[model samples]
Target chain A: MEMYWLLGLPLAGGITLAFWGHRAHAPEINAAFSLATLIAAGWLTAHIVAEGPVLIGGDGWFYIDAFNVFLVALTAFVAFTTALFSRPYMRIEQAHGRVNAARLRLYHASYQLFIGTMLLALTTNNMGILWVAMEAATLTTVLLVSLYRTPAALEAAWKYFILCGVGIALALFGTILLYFAAEQVLGAGGGALSWTHLNAVKTRLEPVVLQLAFVFLLVGYGTKVGLVPLHSWLPDAHGEGPTPISAVLSGLLLNVALYAVMRSKVLVDGALGGASLAGALMMGFGLLSVLVAALLIRRQTDVKRMFAYSSIEHMGLITFAFGMGGMVASFAALLHMTVHSLTKSAIFYAVGHATQKAGTQVMEDIRGLIKTNPTIGWGLILGTIAILGVPPFGVFASEFLIITTTMHQHPWATPVLLTALGVAFAAMFGRVQPMVFGETTLPRLPHQPALLPVFVHLALVLMLGLFIPGYLAHWYRQAACLLGG
Target chain B: MSLTYHLQVVNLLAALLLLIAFAMLSQRRIVGLITLFAWQGAALATSTAIVAWSTGQHHLYYSAALTLGLKVVLVPWYFFRLIRQLDVDREVEPMINIPTTMLIGIILVIFAFNLALPISQMAGTVTRSTLGIALASVLLAFLMMITRSKAIPQVIGFLAMENGLFFAATSATYGMPLVVELGVALDVLVAVFVLGIFFFHIRETFDSMDLKHMERLREK
Candidate 1:
């Protein structure tokens, strides 16, 4: 019941917001709805903590365990904060005539729908439902990505739609294959489609079929997760979409997709008799994505695109950590998900405000953010520091765990990982510092920037860096156990 | 019907589906490509119904009806309407020439057959031999998508590829659950509508329908 409300609130809010988006208070409505959903998520999380895991819906259509309850909470929390940030940022765009009321309605509507689909993807015990929800997310974000209706925006949206569309179609094929494999063992019907049942019977499944299914599923969901060679769509989608959309794209949607991959990875790993073929494949893709994104980040002229590449890099690191497949590595990967979501959303919020003030996303043209708006400049720098894994931030804590664990377990990967991380750090800071501290190139636009969400996120990351609360640590540890089992 | 005769008939329909897929790949005219797509869908539906009838799977009857309604009749109707409204039914020149594409399509078909051999042997379905044809059609549709310069033809290719996947599901594992099939059908419909709207936006943005125009958005 509580779980349904956690899913229902955002969906209901999204529909209502869409209907009332032309009203002057639409942003407020969006914020209130998001806050309501966040509260419900928190309530659900508390319940899970008190009661162990919660499985609702007949045959467990909705399952909330240690692994995903935290993610759901994180998704809602970030959505709420991004909503707060979007209020000011979007209003500024409206003032600049970059958006009209009709577009606002679309934005608010799709924003909620995006949240709903991600939540659906995260919660559903049915693999088919998960794929549907993922596809729904892609569709809604496609609308949002093309919101600006510029040639570039359309191009980005088109590429995103076609690439992900094909990728997910292949994923569907993989899903069907999995069903075929499971049907023979589980004896068909709904039990074969349920995650709990599939995981229970995973070791008994056929290896060849499961291997083929995993390959397709890997390429399919991996496209959504923005793995290298399949990640051409990520930067474009991020660069062209609204800043809030970009925030959610990095902070929430990508994680949901990776979560799907991780679930499938566990099954594939089990079926492969600990051969770790799936882990090696994931590590290969992860290392390549990190290296590719690191190099790509240096070439980016657009601030949003640069961060988009940074997202790919971080997602790669998380994938790599999970691929390492130990208790500590999975723990670190989960923590990385949390910290990356918080810190990256903060960075996007700051970047959104800064770009709005400077009237361009072009980094070199929009200089002296610190000089013109000290709040935004420092926020951007601080947020970037948090993302770049500096000390006293949660990212550094997780990255440190990942590095040390990799050195102990897979010594060969550590140098490559460190070099990629190093290259990414250099590329990011080298582009960002000049933008923050250089001479002001554009006149400051008049607006009350939303700095609250940015600061709030930064503060949370800072707290998490120094200390993770006991209950939270226990939650991650439990999830790690489940993942590594 | 005798089992061998029914299997042969299914194989014949599968061959027709593959031929249409190749025809779609080499097709230069938009309307002709769409017609090829509809024919491919018709062939797929016939084969699915035949498989369902011969095997008595029963659920695949619903699947056959869906393919006929959505693919053979409704989707092509939608595409025809879309092309009519756009008033841009021009030639769809390939990025690679037609002969090269056909040659590549033949190679892909051979490759798909080889790849499907092991999997098809694993599948116990009577229509297992058609699995190679299904895989070939899927690859050929993908090749069409890569070679076509026009957006609508690419979309048609995507739809055709879905047809192959549907056939693959039927041949390999007697089709997915009815609910998942319905969901996928609805999804494909909604995706087409979304892509339709995007077509207008893309054309409006660039004053043309060439995907080549979109290359400008790439990183330098």
Candidate 2:
């Protein structure tokens, strides 16, 4: 089945790379595995389009709907491109003596395993399995985040482990509460935890218990989504890890966490019978994250850390859009999720090469990117422009939809959202322009940088900005309907 | 009468579990904390087994065995070995003193009981009353994590929190499906191993297990 290949290849690749990832060709092998995963994801996407949503495996363990199927494809595509970018990036890290053979092996193995766990989390129908997958993803990435074994890296990993560990423990308690409510209706069995069955009988579930569960689930997964107050671990993790890991953490992992939150939102909304309690909570957190992260971006000296804050801000906008909960808002949230992941990862790719060329992570130390290498500089500038919601880009289109929807639905919040957007735009452009355009002091790298994936992602964003294909638009409408206000 | 007797025993164990959680909150020595964590795990396993026997939810028996094997025996053994190897078995000074931590733990327990009252009423399981104690222990563990500055005790705090969650699952829903329980158990075991590896790395890097040395990554 297409589902098997889609899930099994990364798992298989993880195992193979764990054993032989120290070889010189390991980066190529890693890319090959990711490409195969993308192909499998492509095949699975086609199958879903042809046959519609499906429940695969024994007892219908893997649920693939229009909601998650597109995310699965996007996850696979971004992961593959990240692997392409990392090939050269990791090689450069090795050339600099930043990582040796064993660490490289660890990075490659954990990379595949991380992708597998995210895919598993996205597909699993069981809430408990989803929790396990999310925890496993955390474990795999903690090691990768600390791959360099520097003091900062270890501290970041430790903070990531403890904070997320505690947060996820709360989520498990929430899951137990959900099961407690469900078993009263469905009886003691596996069906009590299956999302499909729960959704079918959601109306009959206890509203009080569902409300409590959603709070815990949101705070728990929201910690991973880099929502503020719970977001301290995120920027450090991004700032300290290898650039490729930062790319996926920003572009893919945060999206997966947001997807988990949205899934829980749907169930809670159904149980509450048109009450907007969950939506109100999401809106509060989302707006707070945007306002806080936009301001925090100005204080960042590390480029990756600054961009990580931007990710929090963008995720906030998407979460806010979803919280508004209507056809147009949900569609905009989905589009924002797509564009943000593409644009952010592309930006990280450019940042990665820029740091390598300048041999420092501090924004002030890196200068004259345009003079040193035009391709990397242009890539960084363009990606930043796209991400800042400049016109004729996918991010702009999505942000436009989100802002317009907010204005119509919740006029009181519109001015505040615009203020945050303006602050974030000024902060980002002010910091990035000097880094990209000003100086010629940096040296060129020995090897050719991989700018292809950067351009590839940017081109896709441009196309989506200009025109969204009919099938994709239809898909978004179906998914938005499934995620009803 | 037999059913009531079983319930009484479970309640007594739940009380003992709460006592150990409070003790862990006040314990200053890392060794004492790990020992208390193991005791908490023992109480949890005994209570889970009792629930399984009384309710005949056979899958809960496997969960009980897992708690015993992983929490009581294997993880504690690993912690003992790890502390011995890392030379970090010293007295840990909490950021807040002991009496204050205990006071906060008490308040948390009261809050947890209040929160659990309505939810426990809705739970049909015979052991549902223990849900309050379960939640209280989780909060106590979280409090312990926040107050401790050392790396190892904080990890113990995390493991204790997991024990509390397991207690909640068994008390509320008679344990999850066998498959889910197995997956959760495997994840906990792997987490312990991974954290153990990090202990050596952290010690090697910082030259001490105190987390204060890790304040290098903060914003200016």
Judging by lDDT against the true structure, name the best candidate.
2
Fnat scores for every prediction: 0.54, 0.85
Instruction: Give the TM-scores of the predictions, in the order they appear.
Output: 0.97, 0.99
Docking class of 1: medium
Model 2 residue B108 CA deviation (Å) reads: 0.5
Residues A1-485 of candidate 1: C-alpha lDDT, one tens digit per residue: 77888889878988898778688899999999899889989998999999987678877888889999999999999999999999989999999898999999989988988898899899988787788889889988898999999888988998898889889988988898888788888875666877888888889988898888888888999999999989999999998988999999999999999999988888888888877878888888998998899888889999999999999999999999898898999999999999999999999999998888877899888788888888899999999999999998999999999999999999998989898889889988988999899987576768889899999999999999999999999999999998875
Clashes of 1: 0
Worst 10 residues of 2 chain A by lDDT: A436-445
What is the per-residue lDDT of model 1 for residues B124-203, given as tens digits with 9 covering 90 to 100? 77888888898899899988887777789888988888899999989888888777788788888888888888888887
Local accuracy by lDDT, each model = 0.89, 0.92
Instruction: Indicate the fraction of true inter-chain contacts that candidate 1 also forms.
Output: 0.54
Q: List the candidate 2 regions with Cα displacement exceeding 4 Å.
A: B91-96
- Which candidate comes out best when scored by TM-score? 2
